[model samples]
Target: MASKSAKKVNLLDHNSIKHILDESVTEVVKNQGYVEDVRLSNAKLLIGTSIIVVALIAQFYKKKFPENRDFLLACIALYVLFNGLLQLISYTKEKNAILFTYPPAGSFTSTGLVVSSKLPRFSDLYTLTIASADPKSISANEPVHFTKSITGWFTNDGVLVEGLFWKDVEGLIVQYTKEPKKSK
Candidate 1:
């Protein structure tokens, strides 16, 4: 019952939610001079998870199919290896981006904005965390997060958000971060 008291933003609308990501990136760039500094707990997790998966797969194959263990192991190893290399390449490409911790977003890890660069097709997912300084609107102390994927080849593109909502995002960011507002 208490859950109904606090409203939450839908995390599935790709178009509407894209506003948060675009505005946040704009806020950091237009106002902060393209500052790119924030902690991202997700990248490390990606590499770490890859290692753990390879180990787990090896264990599974060793127990269930010992007859063809080496061949299976080699195949799994190649797959994980390919994924790791992709992650590394994506990182070097997105060094200009910044990350922030938005709790309600997926794992609260892979959410961020790319400053001054085109959105890369593989990595650096954007998260929508709408925070407020005013106590009246949806969120004041805690931020409201919305998320949609534009990270892969299938649906990735420039984040397009409505102008009115974008203005709201700009105001919220400036209100909290003390950055100057970016004019529309």
Candidate 2:
């Protein structure tokens, strides 16, 4: 797959973009270059451990808080533990893929979109970067910090990406990251 100079990208179609976001991460990971990020595995485990410590402290010392607080602490500990376990699974796959990949998948409907280009810094192609924005939210629209400069991080708006449609994102990826001829 070679990166095309004239491929076209569609940024206005929020519905189609949402459809992709709604699709299972598991299905998307079936393609090349899609890795399950476990960057916070250690952090999540540490959080769960801390919660357990708090729970233990609550049990050991009575009346520092209410009796119900003890139960609440225990419940929070359990929830964090469950999430930590799932993170551990992702961490193992980050080591190497085995049977399959799964996500503690979540869904949140957003109301807007933000599209930008990652030109001059990380990519040589006029690669596209998109983000979902919530029209109703009052929070900042700070861009996500992404590491590992890859295919989608380019723009001269250099590559028009003509002819190809946006639904074929995977194909677009193939076009952009095709292996060099020397390898063949």
Per-residue C-alpha lDDT of model 1 across residues 157-179, encoded as one tens digit per residue: 43233343345445555454433
User: Model 2, range 45-110, lDDT digits (tens) per residue?
Assistant: 776677677667656664655656757677676767767776775565332221122221341322
Look at candidate 1 and tell me the lDDT of residue 78: 70
Which residue runs of candidate 1 sit more than 4 Å off their true CA positions? 1-31, 38-42, 45-49, 52-64, 67-98, 101-166, 178-184
Enumerate residue pairs that collide in model 1. Answer: none
Estimated TM-score for each candidate: 0.29, 0.27
Badly placed stretches (over 4 Å) of model 2 are 1-22, 62-167, 175-184
